[model samples]
Target chain A: MSYLAFQLKKVFKNKLTPVCLAILLLLMGTVLFMNVRTNPQFSLQAGAKSEIAYRQKEINRQQRLLKHDKQKSKTEVYHDTKAAIKQNQDAVKQDKQVQKAANKGNWRKAYTIMWQQKKQEQTISSNGQDLAGINSRINVEKKLQFFNYLHHEPLPYESQDMPVTGWQFLLQLNQQYLPYVFTLVALFLLTLLLTDSYHQKLDTAQLLPLEKNNLMISNTIAGIVLTLGSFLAINLVLFIVASLIYGTGSLAFPYIVGQYTGGRPLIECISTGSFIIKVIVLQVLTFIFEVVLVQFLARIFRDKLPALLIAILLVPGLNIATMIVEPLRKICAWLPMTYLNAVDIVSGNLGMNYQNVQLNYTSGLLTLCCSILIITIMILLSSYIKYKE
Target chain B: MLTVQNLSLKTRQPILHDFSYQFAPGQFYQIAAENGSGKTSFLRAVTDLIPASSGKVLLDGKPYAKNKRKLFFFESNEWLNVNLTSLDYLKFVKRQWHSNVDLDQELDLLGVREYVKVPIKKYSLGMKQKLIVAMYLVSGAEYYLMDEITNGLDEESRAILYERLNNEVTQRNKCIILTSHYSSEIKVNNLHRLVLHKQKMHEVKQ
Candidate 1:
C-alpha cells in the first residue's frame, strides 16, 4: 500500500484522534443547538421595535411642546415626526406584514414581519471605485447559489419563532461562523496528519521509496483528503441528526442575496440550495489553503508544538490584525485570512464596514489562490533543504 | 555496491571532512565513533536526512537519491509511531519496499511473534529494537544504513541480529553498514571495521 493509505488507516485507528473528532462534533452540535433554542428573528424584532419606541417618544415630546407653545408653528411638530414617519413608510413598503401591522401603529409586529420576509435582498450601488467591490459581493452570492446547484448542497431555513427545523438550525449559522468552525477543525486534522508528524521527525519518511517532493506531496494530498472527508462527515452527521430531531425542513427555501453601492440595494431570492453550495465551495477552498498553510509551517519548524501553535494562532491573528490594528485596515481586504469569514466577504460587509479596505469574493479567491501557490512553491523549495536549516 | 566519494558535513564547527569509502556486496562494515564524532551525522547525511556540505553518494555509478528504493536507512529505532502494531509496521514496510519477506517468520525469529497485534508503545525496549531489525531484514534493499540499532536489545536478541546480518552478507549478497561495534559481532564472518578519527574515515584491522 502507498504511505498515504497507511497514514489514513493509522490516523483513523489512532486512539486520541478519534476523541478529538468527537470533541469537534460535540462542539458543533452544542453551538448549532444553542442557535436553534434562541430565535434570531426575535433579536432583530426587538432591536427595530426599540428604535421605533424611541422615535415615537420623540414625536410625542414634539407634539406636547407644540400644544404648550403658541409661538411655535405646526411646521416644527411635523418636522420632528418626519424622520420617524419616513422610516415607518420605508419599513411598511418593504414588507406586507409590516405594512399591515404599521397601519395599526404596531412597530414591534412591523419589525417582526420585516425580518420574517420570505426573501430579503439589499442593493447598494457603486459609482466611484466601488464597482469592483459591488461585483465581488454579487459574485460571492452568484457563486454561492450557482455552486449549491452544482454540488447539490442543502441549506437550512431562516430562523423564526416557529417550530425549529434542522434546516433552520443550519440557516442561522451564517457563512461567517461556519468557515471559522470548519477551519478550526480542519487545522486540527491537518495537524494530526502532517505538521505533527513532520515536526517530531519521528519517522524517516524521507527514506521512503518516493522522492522528497513526492513524499511531501503525498502527505499533503492525504491531509487535505482526510480533513475534507472528516469535515463533510461531521457536517453530514450533524445535518442528519438535526433532521431526525427537528425535521428536514424545506430545501426550497429562499435565500436573500444583495449588492449595494450608491443605487437602491439590488436583492434577489435564489433557492437556499444554491446559496449553500457557494458556502460549501468557499469552505473547500479555505480547507485547501489551510492544509497547505499548516504543512508549510510544519516543514519550516520541524517540531510539532511550535508549528501547531503558529497554525492555531494564524486563524485569529489575521482577523485581529486587520480588524483591531488601524494601520492594517486598508490592506486587510487583500489578505486571504480576511476571507476566512467568507460569508461576510461574500455579502461585502467585510469591506463595507471597514470602508478603508476593498474586498469581495473575487479578491478573496485570488488571495487564497496566490497564497496556496506561493506556499506550495516554498514547500517544494524547503523540501530540498534541511529541516532544521 | 555502494560508494561515498569525499562525503563531508559541517554544522557550526566541522564534524566530518574529506570522507570517502566503498563497500561491495556480500560484506558487512562496522563503523564506531565517540559521541559527537559524526557517526550519526554521517548516516543521516548519506540518507538525505541532513544535506552534506559537499560530496555525493552513489550506487553502481548512479546518484543514490534517484535510486532510493535500493537502500534502506533505519535512522532511529525509538522514533517510531507507537500507535501502529508490529504487524502493521511490517506490512507497511513490505508494501513500500514491495518485499515478500514473511511477516510471521521474521517476528518469530526475533521472538516477538505474539505481539504482532499489540501497539508498539506497550512493548519492552528490546521488543521495539527487534521490530526495527526485522524491518531492515525484510526491506529487500541492497544497501542498509542502520544507526545505533542495538542500543536497547537484550543478549539473545543481539545474537539474533548478528545472525540476520551474517545471512544478509553471505546468502543474500547484501551490504550491511551499521554504526557502533559490540564484541558479539566477532562471530560474524567477512566483516570489516572502520573507526572515525580526526574528521576522517580510517580502516582498522579487527
Candidate 2:
C-alpha cells in the first residue's frame, strides 16, 4: 500500500472514527424524527386569521384614541376610527373567503386571495403610506414576487413544508445545520488524525526514509480524504434513508436567496438544487481550509489535546466574535470563519446579518481559497526552515 | 560509513559534549553507556530525530537528510501506533524505503505471523518488539541505529535477531550500531563495543 493509503487506514482504524460517525448518524436520525413530528407547511387560512386579528387590534386602538384624546382634532380622530373599522371588517370578510376555499381543499383560490392582499400591501408600502419603513416595503415586494413565482410553477410540496423526501431532507440538513456540523466534524477528525503521532509520543512513519515535507503532505492528504470522505458518506446514507421513506422531492423547489440588496430588485431565487450545489462547493473549500488549519495547529502546539481543543473551539469562537463585535462584523469579509456558514452565505442571509454586502458566496469562496493557500505556504515554509536549521 | 563530528546534545544539562565517532560498513558495534549518559539521545540525534546541541551527522560523507533512505532508525516500540495492525506498519516502512524485501518472509522470520493482523494495542510487549524489528528488516536500510531492541525479547527471539544481524553485516556489508544495557546478551563475532562516559566515547573492546 502507498503511504497515503496507509495513513488513511490508520485514521479509519482509529477508535475515534466509528464514535464520531455514530454520533453524526444519531443526530441525523433525531433531525429526521423531529421533522416528522412538526410540520412547517404554510396555511393560507391560518395566515388570514392572523391578519384579521392584527386589524382588530388596530380598530380597538383607534376607538380608544377617539374616546380619550379630546385635545386632538375630532374630524381627524373620526376619520382614523372609520378607516380602522372598515379595514377590520374587510379582514373578517377575507378570512371567511380563505376558510371557505381551504375547506374545499382549494388551496389555489386561497393562495390567490392571499396573493391579492399582499399585492395591495405591496402597492401601499411602495407608495410610502404603510408607515412600517423601507424594510417592510421590501419584504412585501419579495412576498409578492414569490407568490407570483409559486402560482406559475407550483411545487408538489409547499416550499415551506417540512422536508418530505430525501432530496429535501438533504437540502434542509445542508441549509440549516450541515455547515457547522461539517466544519466541526472535520475539525474533530482531522485534529485527532494529525495529532495521533504526537499523542503516541512517537510517529513511526516520521522515522521512515522520507523527507519531513513529504510526510506532512501525506498526512494532510490523508486527513482531508478521511474527514471529507466521511462527510460525503454520511450524507449519502441519510439521503438514501430519507429518500426511500419519502420519494425523492422535486429539485425545482424555489428558495428565496434573501432580498437583493445589490440593486432595487425585490428578491432573487434559484432552484433549491442549485442553491444546494453552491453550498457544497463552498463547503468543500471550507473543509479544505479546516484540514489545513488543524494541521497548522497540530504543528504549533505539538500536543494532541491542545491542538484538538483549540481547533474545536476556534470555529465557534470566531463565529461568535464576528457576530457580536461590530468592528469584527465589518471586517468579516476577510475572516475565514465567517464563511463556515456556507448555507447562510450562499443564501445571502449571512451577508444580510453581517450588514456587509460583500460576504456573499463568491467572496466566501475566494476568502477560503486564499486562506488555504496562505496557511499551506506558511506550513511548508516553517517545515523547510525547521528542517534546514 | 556514518560519521559524527563534534556532536553535542543537551537536555536539562549537557549529555554529550563534543563527541565524535566514525562507523564503517561490514561491522557490528555496541554502544555502552551509563543510565543517563545519552545513549538513546545519541541514536535519536544521529537520525536527526532529536536535535543535537551542536555538530552535524553525515552518511557517506553527505548530510543525513540527503541519505535518509540509507539509514534506518526505529527509535522504540513506543513509537508504534497501537491502533494499526503490524502489517500496516510493515507495509508503510517498506514503501517509504522502497524496499524489495518480501514482507511475508520478514514476518515469518520474526515469528509475528500469528498476531500480524491484530492491532498493536492487543499485542504483548514482546510481540510489539518483534513487529518493530520486522519494520527495520523490511526497510532494507544499510545502516541500522537500534536502541535496546532486545529489551522485551525472549532468548530464542534474541538469538534469531542476532543471527539476522550477523548475516546483514557479514554477507550484505551492512553497518549496525545498537545500544544495550546488558552487553553479555549479545553474542556475535568480532563485536566492537564502545562505552560512553564523561560526554565522550571510549573504545572498550574490539
Q: Per-residue lDDT tens digits of candidate 1, residues A1-389?
A: 67887777667766766676688788877876775566544443443565556656665765666567656545666566555556545544444454455556664554444433321332322233476776655644443443343234323223433324565456544453456666666676677667535423633676788767778777777887777787777767777887787687776755555544464344455665666666666667777788888888877777767777898788757776788888777888666677777656665556655763346666777888888899898888876555433
lDDT, candidates in the order shown: 0.69, 0.79
For DockQ, the strongest prediction is: 2
How good is model 2 by TM-score?
A: 0.89
Q: Against the true structure, candidate 1 has what lDDT?
A: 0.69
- lDDT at residue A253 of model 1 (Cα atoms): 59
Model 2 lDDT at residue A222: 91
Worst ten in a row by lDDT for model 2 chain A? A199-208
True contacts kept of 2: 0.61
Per-prediction CA RMSD (Å): 6.8, 3.8
Counting clashing residue pairs in each candidate, in order, gives 14, 0
Task: Please report the TM-score between candidate 1 and the true structure.
Answer: 0.79
Look at candidate 1 and tell me the lDDT of residue A152: 44
